[model samples]
Target: MKRLFLVLIPLALLAGCLEVDQHPHWVKGQYAGKKDDLPFQTHFHRDRLSWWGTISNRNQHQNEYNRANP
Candidate 1:
């Protein structure tokens, strides 16, 4: 049992090192879509009065450009 574990342990460690030099498919640009484009995009519309008010208030808080300029 001890001899078997010693041989198996080195083989397992060496197997992990073999993958160190290989790059993943995604990093090599194997997936579709433009490189600069977001993976997902969402389009939202405010159809309700409450939603409109909430989104509007959130946008105001997030509007750094106006706050910075003012």
Candidate 2:
């Protein structure tokens, strides 16, 4: 049981390290196993933020048009 626990624990930690919470483009361009991948990290969060901003702008523009016509 002790041996099994040791092996499983290491495997779980390895799996955690493999997982990254960022876009592939960001990971490849910015991170990519470089030592300076921390401070310059821009990934899925940035992508999502930009997307949300675009959507909000579009919605605001649509509302303005509707108000002007109505």
Top candidate (lDDT): 2
Which stretches of model 1 miss by more than 4 angstroms?
Answer: 20-70
Worst 10 residues of 2 by lDDT: 37-46
Count of clashes, each model: 0, 0
lDDT of 1 by residue, 1-70 (tens): 9999999998988886756555434646575445553222222342466666767898998988866865
Q: What is the lDDT of residue 68 in candidate 2?
A: 98
Candidate 2 backbone overlaps, count: 0
Whole-model lDDT values for every prediction: 0.64, 0.66
Predicted structure 1: clash tally:
0
**Global Cα RMSD, each model:** 9.3, 12.1
User: Which residue pairs collide, candidate 1?
Assistant: none
For each candidate, what TM-score against the reference?
A: 0.28, 0.28
lDDT of 2 by residue, 1-70 (tens): 9999999998888887876677544564575654544321343343666767777788988886665965
